[model samples]
Target chain A: MTNPTAAMLVIGDEILSGRTRDSNMHHLARELTLRGIDLRESRVVSDDHDGIVAAVRALAAAHDHVFTSGGIGPTHDDITAEAVAAAMDTPIGVRDDARGILAAHYEARGVELNAARLRMARIPDGATLIDNPVSAAPGFSLRNVHVMAGVPRIFEAMLAGLLPSIPGGRPVLSQSVRVERGEGDVAEPLADLAKAHPALSIGSYPFSENGVTGTNIVIRGAEGAEIEAALVQLSERFGA
Target chain B: MTNPTAAMLVIGDEILSGRTRDSNMHHLARELTLRGIDLRESRVVSDDHDGIVAAVRALAAAHDHVFTSGGIGPTHDDITAEAVAAAMDTPIGVRDDARGILAAHYEARGVELNAARLRMARIPDGATLIDNPVSAAPGFSLRNVHVMAGVPRIFEAMLAGLLPSIPGGRPVLSQSVRVERGEGDVAEPLADLAKAHPALSIGSYPFSENGVTGTNIVIRGAEGAEIEAALVQLSERFGA
Candidate 1:
C-alpha cells in the first residue's frame, strides 16, 4: 500500500502577524513522521473564513488526512469550525458528545458553562469528537480532516489520542553523515550516489557555523538496511 | 501609509514528505515583522509547477509582496524559477547579471560551470538579482515576488540584502502577559479589552505545562504606546 499522506493547516492571525512563533507544524511533522504518515503540505493561514475554507478544501482533497490547528476557541475570531463546516458543505451545530465533554469539564472544575464557552462545544455535522485531555474543548474529525486545538500541549495530547487510530505505512528511516566539505565539492559524487540508490532520498544540507563550513548529508528511505547501506557508501566515497 | 503586506510560498517535496522541518518560515516572519511588513498568509506547496504557478498568481495579486523560499537550486526538481516566470507570463533566459554572479562564483571555487550549474543563472525577464553572499547562485525579484534559496541561512542572507531596498511602514509592536488561567475563564475579559482597543489585536494563546493551565495574552499593533496601554488593562483585568 502507498503511504498515507497528510497536510496541516495552522489557522491563527497571531501567526501571520508574527506575534506568535508556531510550534504546531514542527510538533505535527515529528509526530506524523514517527507514525509513518507523510505530511505533504502545511499552510499557515489567518483567521479569515475564505482563507481557511480554500486551504481546507484543497488540502483535504489532496491528502489522506488534513489536520487543522487553532481557531477552535471561544473568541469572536475563532471561526475554524464554521469554516471547516462550510468547506465540507456540512451543517454545523453543537454536538451532544462535545457538549458532554465540555459540561463534564466545567462541572469538575466548578465553573459555569456560559454562552461563549458553549462555542467550543459546537462541531460540524457527521463528525467524531477527538477528546482533548488537557482542555475541555474537544476537537472533531470529519471524514479526513482532524480539527484540533492550537495550544501546544492540547494539540499534542489530541494528536496522541488520534494518530494511533489511523492506519500507517512503514515509517521513514533516516541517517545523517556530517561532512566538512562544501556542497559544491561533493555535489557530483553525491548526485551519483543518489542515482545509484533509486529507493533512497539523499539530501545535502550546507551549513556554516563559527567559521566552519560543512554539509549534513541525509539519506532516508523506508528500509533501514538500505538507508544504512547508502550511508556506508557515502562515508566510503566522501572520507568523512 | 498602510503596511506593506506580504505572503510566503514554500516549495519543496522534502518538506511535504516530512523529511525536512522548515525553518525559513519563522525567519521570514520575524524579518517581515521587524521591517513592518504585514505577512498575511503562508503556503507550503509541493515542487509541482502548476501548484507553484497557481499560488504565485493568487498571492502576488492579493499581497503587496510575495516571497518564496526553496526550489531554486540546480537540481532537476528545482522548478521555482520556471514556475515564477510562467505565473508572471514572462519569458525566462540566462540574464547577464545573474550569469556574472555565477561565473564569479565558479571561478572562486575553481569548479567547471556545467549546464546544471548555469541553470542557477537563468532568471525571468525584467527581474533584479538578489545577491546571495553565502552562495554563488543569486535569488531574483520579479515584480514584487522575491525568490530566494531554499536553505535557511542562504534565504536569510538573500532577504537581508533585499529587505532594506523596500520601504516599510510602522513596525508592529507587541506585549505579552502570561495568565495562569483557563481561556474560558479569561475569554470575557479579553473580549472586553479587545473591544476597548479597536486598533490593537488582543489574542489569548492557551497552553499547559506540568498540569498548569494558562494563556499568554498577546497585544499587538503598530503603536507601542497603544500596545502598552492594552497590556496594562489586560494585567489589571486578568490579574497577571
Candidate 2:
C-alpha cells in the first residue's frame, strides 16, 4: 500500500492555554510527509493522566503508527510515559538502558542526578529506547506508539532516530499558484478545477493584504507530474 | 467550575497527508483562551468513518465541549456528519432547518440545490443549528459536539455565532520576556520564579538564531498583575 497511516499526540498544558505556540506539530507533519508516512491524526492533550491515557489508547488502536510529543520531561506535569503505560495496561519503571543514558549525560555535565532527573529514565515495559542526540534522556517505542520528548530540539533528534527504523510509503507531492484575487471571485473556477482533478486534492487558502484579498491555490497528489500539470493550469487561468 | 474544558476534532485526509496546513486549531486555541474555555485537547482524524466516530466519542466523554471541523462539505470525502451520527447512534437525515438555509443560499446564487449540495445539509438528529454567515450551510451541535464547516472563513463565522451561546470562565492572561540566553543558563532561576508563584504557569521556550540561543520565558495565570510581576522579575534576571 502507498498510504502508511500515523497519528500524533501532543501532551502539554502550556500549548492548551496559548502560552506556547506549538512548533513540533508542524515539524512532525513535514518530517512524516518526507518519510512518506501519512500523519493521519494529531491530538493535543493536557498533562492530565486520564486524558493522556485515553488519547494514547484510542489513537494507537486506530492508526498504523502513533507518535507522541511532550510530557516526558522531569517536571511535575510531565506524565506521558506513565500515562502510556496505564493506557497499555503494562508495567512502568526505570529501565537500565535509559538510566545509563541519563547517568552518562549528567556525569558528563557534572550535575547531581536528582530524583526529578531520574524520572526521565523511566520507561514503559517492552519498549525499545530511541536515542536523542540533542538531549541525553531517550525516547522509546512500544508496539505502534513512539514516545519522544516535548522540547523541539530533542523531539526532532528523536524523530530522526526513529524514522529510519520504520518503512515508509510513496511521498506526497504538491504545487502551488498564488493568485492576487479573492477566493470569492475564484471559488467557482477553483471548484471546477478541483472537480476535474478527481484523483488530486486541491485547496484554496485566502489571505487579506492591505484591504485586498488573495488566494493561494494548492494542488497535491502522490504523482509529481500531475501536481505540476495542475499548477501550470491554475497559473494559466488565474496567476497574476 | 468556571473553567470550561474543550477539545477540537479536525476530520480530514488532507491534513494527515500534509496536503493542507491546519489553521483551525490555532484559531480555536486563541478564541478559547479569550473565552476562558480551556482547550485541553485537539484531534485531527481522517475521512474514515471509524476514526471520526471513535475520536468523537472519546473526546466528547472527556471534555466539557467538543468542536469538530471539516468533513461536512458536499463531496464524497466529507463524512463527519455521518460519522458523528454513527458515534451517537442517531439516524442521519437532511435537517429541515439546514436544508432551508442551504436551499436559500443556492437560490440566492442562482445555482441548483443538487444532491451533492444536499449532502451538506444531512445532520445528526436532534442537534441545534450553528449558523454559517459566510456560506449559509449551517452547522449543528449535538450534546457537546459542535460541528462546523472546514473552510476557514465559514468555520470562523460559525464559531463567532456559537461562542456567545456557550458559557465561559476567567480568561487566561500571559506575559512574555525574550532572553538571549540558553535554557540551561536560565532554567534554575526560572524554576525558582515558578516556585514563588504557585498560581502562575511558567514555561521556557528556547530557540536559536545565528548560532546564538535564546529562551522566551512565558508567565501565565488568571491574574494580570501576577503575570506582569513575573515578567518584571524575568526581565531583571535576564533582560538585555
Candidate 3:
C-alpha cells in the first residue's frame, strides 16, 4: 500500500524576515518518515491572513495530512486560528473545554484569564484540541490539518502525542554506499541499478572532501532485503 | 515603493526525506531582506518532475521573481533543468556556451567530458547563465526564475553575484523591544501601536525561559526615522 502523504505549512513573519530559522520542518520530516508517512511538500509563508488561508486550503486539499506550525499565540500577530477556520468554513468561538484547560493552568500560576489570554480558547466548530504540554494554550485538529505551536519544544511534544493516533505505512528502509568518485563517474551504473530495481528510490548526493569529489548513493525501499541486495550490488559495481 | 516580491522553490528528495536539512532558505531570506526584496513565500518539493513543474509554474506566476535551488547536477536524479524548462514552455538543450565552460574546466583537471558529465551543459532556451566559481557547472536564469545549485556554498556564491543585477526597493529597517511579560499582557497595547503606525509591520514572538514567559515586540519599516520613533514609544509603554 502507498504510504500516507503529508504537507507542512509554516506560518510566521519572523521566519520570512530572517529573524528566526525554522527547525520544526526538519523534525516533522524525520518523524513522519519514521512513521512511514511521505512528507511530500512544505511551505513557509509570512503572517498574512489571505496567504495563510490560501496555503492551508491548498495543502489540506492535496495531502492526506497537513501539519501547520506558528501564529497561534495570544499576541495580535497570531491570526492562524481565524484564517484556518475561515479556510475550513467553520465558525470559531472561545469553547469551554479549551478555556477550562487554559484557566486551570494559568490560575494555578496566579495569572488572570484576561481578554487577550482568553483568545487562546478559541476553537473551530467540530474540531478537537491537540494538547500542548509546554504551554497551556492547546492546538486544534480541524479536519485533517493539525495546528501546532511554532515553538520547537512545544511542537515536538505535541507531535509525540499526536503521531501514534495517525495511521502509517511500512517503515521505509535505507542504505547508502559512498564512492570516492565524482557524481558523473557514478551516474551511469547507478542509473542502471535504479532502472533494474523499479520499486526502490535511488538517489545520489555529491560532496567534496579534502579536494576530492565524491558521491553518496542512497537506496530506500519498504523491503529491507531489497535494500541490502541493492547495497551489495552497488558495492560490487564500485568496488568500495 | 513596494519591494519586489519573490518566492523560493527548493527541489530535492534529500530535504523532503529528512536526509538533509535545508539552510538555503534562511540564507536567501536574509540576503533578500538586505537587498530590499520581500521573500514572501518558500516551498520545498521532492525531485519529482511533475511536482517541480507545478511548483515552478505556480510560484513564477504569483510572484515577481522565483528562485529555485537543486535538481541540476550530473546524475540521473538531476531533472530540475528539464522540469523548469517544461514549466516555462521553452525548449532546452546542451548549449555551446555552457558546454565550453564545462569542457575547459574538466579538461584542465585532466577529466574527460563524458556523457554523464556533459549533462551539466544543458540550458533552457533564451536563458542567461549564472556562473559557478566553486564548480564549473553553470546555473541559469530563464525569465524571472533563477535556478541555482543546491549546495550551500555554491548557492550563496551564485546569489551574491545575482542580487546586484536585480532591481530592489529600500532596505527594511527593524528594531525590537523585549517586554518581560507574557504575550497576553502585551497584546492590547501592541495592537494599539500597530494601528498607530499603519506603515510599519509590527510582530510579537513569545518565548519562555526559567519558567517565565515573555514576548519580544519587533517593529519593521522602510523609514528608519519612523522605526526609531516607534521603538521609543514602545519603550515608554513597556519600560523595557
Candidate 4:
C-alpha cells in the first residue's frame, strides 16, 4: 500500500525575518517519515491572512494530512486559528472544552484568564482539540488540518498526542555510502546503479571541507533489503 | 520603496524524507530579509518533474522574484533545469557558452567531458548564467527565477554573485526583549503594545529551559527609530 501523503505549513514572520530559525518543519518531517507517511511538500509563509489561508486550502486539498506550525500563540500576531477558520469557511468561537482546560490550569496557578489569554480557547467549528501538555492552551485538528503551536516543546507534545490516531504505511528505508571523490568521478556509476534499481532513488551529494572534496551517495526506498542491496553494488563500484 | 517580494522553491527528496535537514531555506531567508527583499513564501518538493514544474510556475507568477535550490547536478536524479524549462515553456539544450566554460575547466585538469559530465552544461534557452565560484557548474537566471545548486557552499557562492543585481528596499529593523515569564503573563501587554504600534510588528515566543519558562518579545519594522521607541515601552512593561 502507498504511504499516506502529508504536507506542512510553517507560519511566522520571525522565521522569515531571520530572528528565529524554524525547527518544527524538520521535526514534523522526521516524525511523519518515521510513521510511514510520505511528506511530499512543505511551505513557509508569513502571518498574513491571505498567505496563511491560501496555503492551508491548497495543502489540505493536495495531501492526506496537513500540519501547521507557528502563529497559534496568544498574541495579536497569532492569527492562525482565525485564518484557518476562514480557509475552511467555518465559524470559530470560544470552545467550552478548550476554555475549561485553560481556565482550570490558570485558576490553579492563581492567574486570571483575561481577554487576550481567553483567545487561546477560540476553536474552529467541527474541530477536536490536540492536547498541549507543556502548556494549557490546546491545539486543534480541523478536518485534515492539524494546527499546532510554534514553540518546539509545545508542538512536539501536540504531535505525540495526535500521531497515533492517523493511519500510515510502511516507513521508507534509506542508506548512505561515502566516496572519497568528486561528483564528476561518481556520476556515471551512480546513474548506472539507478538504472539497475528502478524502484529505488540514488542521490549523489558532493561536499568540500577544508580543501578535501568528497561525495555522499544515498540510496532510498520502502524496502530495507532493496536499499541495502543497492548499497552493496554502490559500495563495490566506488570502493566506499 | 516597498520591499521586493520573493519566493523560494527547494527541490530535493532528502529534505522531504528527513534524511537531511534543510539549512538553505534559513540561509536564503536571512539573506533576503537583510537585503530588504520580502521573502513571502518558500516551498520544498521532491525530485519529481511535475512537482518542480508546478512549484516553479506558481511561485514565479505570484512573487516578484523566485529562487530555487537543488537538483542541478549530473546524476539521473538531477532534473531541475529540465523541469524549470518545462515550467517556463522553454527548450533546454547544452548551450555553447556553458560548454565552453566546462570544456576549458576540464581540459585544464586533463579530464574528458563525457556525456554524464557534459550534462551539467545544459542550460534553458533565454537565460543568463549565475557563476558558481566554488565549482565550475554555473547556475542560471531565467526571467525572474534564479536556479542555483543545492550544496550550501555552492548555493551561497551563486547567491553572492546574484544578490547584488536584484533591486531591494530599506531593510527591516528588529529588536528583542526577553522576559523570564510564560507567554500568558505577556500576552495582554503585548497585544496592547501591538495595537499602539500600528506600523511595528511585535512577536512573542515562549521557551522552557530546565523548568524555567521565558518569553521573547521581538519588535520589527522598516524604521529603526520607531522600533527602538517601541522597545523602550516593552522593556518598561515587562521589566526586562
How do the candidates rank by TM-score, highest first?
3, 4, 1, 2
- Point out the worst 10-residue segment of candidate 3 chain A by lDDT: A170-179
Q: Candidate 3: which stretches are off by over 4 Å?
A: B210-212
Positional deviation of residue A60's Cα in model 3 after best superposition, in angstroms: 1.1
Segments of candidate 2 deviating more than 4 angstroms: A1-4, A33-36, A85-126, A169-240, B89-92, B177-199, B210-214, B224-240
Over A67-95, each residue of candidate 2 has an lDDT whose tens digit, in order, gives 99987766555678999999989899999
RMSD of each: 3.0, 5.4, 1.0, 1.8
Could you give candidate 1's per-residue lDDT for residues A91-143 as a string of tens digits? 99988888888899898989889877998988998999998887668999999
The lowest-lDDT stretch of 10 consecutive residues in candidate 1 chain B is B13-22
lDDT of 1 by residue, B1-240 (tens): 789899999998677666677878888888888888989899888778998999999999999999999988765567899999999999998888888888988888787777767888889999999999888798999999999999988999999999999888788887888889877778888888889888888788877779887878788888888888887787788566
Model 3 TM-score on a 0 to 1 scale: 0.99
Assess every candidate by TM-score: 0.89, 0.76, 0.99, 0.95
User: Which docking category, incorrect, acceptable, medium or high, applies to candidate 1?
Assistant: acceptable
| Candidate 3 lDDT by residue in tens digits, A78-137 | 999999999999999999999999999999989899988999999999888998988879
TM-score of chain A of each: 0.97, 0.93, 0.98, 0.97
Q: Which stretches of candidate 4 lie over 4 Å from their true place?
A: B210-212, B235-240
Better of 2 and 3 by DockQ: 3
Give lDDT: candidate 2, residue A37.
83
Return the DockQ of model 3.
0.86
**In candidate 3, residue A171 scores what lDDT?**
79
Count of residue pairs whose backbone atoms collide, per candidate: 1, 0, 0, 0
How many Å off is the CA of B188 in candidate 3? 1.1
Q: Given the true complex, what DockQ would model 2 score?
A: 0.29
